[model samples]
Target: MLTLYMEVSLTETQQCCGDVEMLFRRWSVLGLVIPTLLIGACSSTPEKEEISEQPAAELYLESKQRMNTGNYRSAIAHLEALLSRYPFGPHADQVQLDLIYGYYAVSDNAAARAAADRFIRLNPTHKDIDYALYMRGLMSEDEDSNFFQSMFNIDRSDRDPAMVRQAFGDFERLIREYPASKYAPDAARRMIALKNRLARYEVRVAEYYYQREAYVASIGRGKYVVQYMSDTPSVERALELMVESYDKLDMPEAKQDTLAVLKLNYPDNSMVN
Candidate 1:
């Protein structure tokens, strides 16, 4: 009876050991599989989330809302995404125009100009072409002067005239190409101001030359002002500058002729007196 009990106990112990070994193997496999499964799940979730594409129409609405709420950056994000995803969508052209406005609103002149140029080049016959041209002219005008200078009454015309001339050209083009466009009136008014400013710039340069006793250079700039910007208020000053320059150069005939013109045009002008 004692021998039988010992053998039975050994057999039970061996069975128990086998069961534990099987459980260990199953747990080991599960450990490796569970980690791989977890890793795969984590990796796939981000990709799925990242690629969640919104419809182009939905993006347009979202961008419009952001713009209405004055959230320009978010509006730009939505607009850019829409453009990337739906290049040929119904709202593509409108989105491009809005981008130009948004960039201009944010004071990003370079991007605004680039977007306007692209729009004009791509959609020559678009109904909104006038608007694009108007916006382009406005961008150039802003480039030549900022709010700070306007607020402080600083003279930006005394600085570079490249942007000024560019703006004038754009405004002139807008007026010439789209005479009946709603933006034409404003563009016309702006062109007048720009012309005056350009004339003043020429006079300022002439004055600088005169101050330095460079009579020839001064006379050249004066003549340019009178010839190019004839309708501007600076014409009187330009004539005066020419007269002074001619006097300095000892050219009596030119001085007398310039004074005569100045007196005929601006009879009460103190410069002529």
Candidate 2:
């Protein structure tokens, strides 16, 4: 093409000087004009085919095959490489989903959480977003979420409340956002377990003070349970302890008030009322 154009241009220039026939003979001898056009046409198709194609389905099948064979790491390797090369690959969602399970199979909680976050961020409106978020919560959940342990750890200077709060909050957020999520029942059940454990811990702490005959301290701790830990199962016991503490302190009016609250709330509780 270049050779022909150059000869044609030269021929046009030459024609203006009355040399037309000689330029055409020169272009024909070099054969540049016909060959270049044919080669250019032949080369175009392969480029277009390459651009308008994908290996996404093949990659997904290979990863799934490896996963089924119990080769999770190999599957991860394939999927991860594909993600970098084809961000909008057809198997993008499946790659992420399998990545989560693969990380779990390899006992890599950090990777599992990362994969879950990536999946959630990329597929915000995905039907499986709730599952991804829930998996993230499970990946990071710690002992502090156990209400029995949380109270003692809450004041632990070495522990970070931010991490614990985030883990629990994710579960709570999932429950609120996807109220009908399959995981919602389990999440709510976990909250109930947490409440029960915390309630028991409060009662145990109050009893410790009571056993030491620190009536005022015992009363304060019981009041703390009633005021702050009201949702816990220990509320009933703490109210009874408050009554006992007030009686020992010879505060008759406070004792009467405690008894009234206990009676009003649990009229069938003969032990306190």
Clashes of 1: 0
Q: Look at candidate 1 and give me any clashing residue pairs.
A: none
Q: Please report, as a residue range, the 10-residue window in candidate 2 with the lowest summed lDDT.
A: 1-10
**Which candidate gets the maximum TM-score versus the true structure?**
1
Where is model 1 poorest over a 10-residue stretch in terms of lDDT? Answer: 1-10
Q: Give one digit per residue, the lDDT tens place, for model 1 in 1-273.
A: 001001001122222223333233323422243334334423222221122388877788877766665555456677778888999988888889878876765556788899999999999988878888888888788667655457678786788789888899888988898999888999999999999888988999999999999999999999998888899999888899899899889999989999999999999988666
TM-score result, candidate 2 = 0.56
Using all chains and alpha carbons, the TM-scores for the candidates as numbered come to: 0.78, 0.56
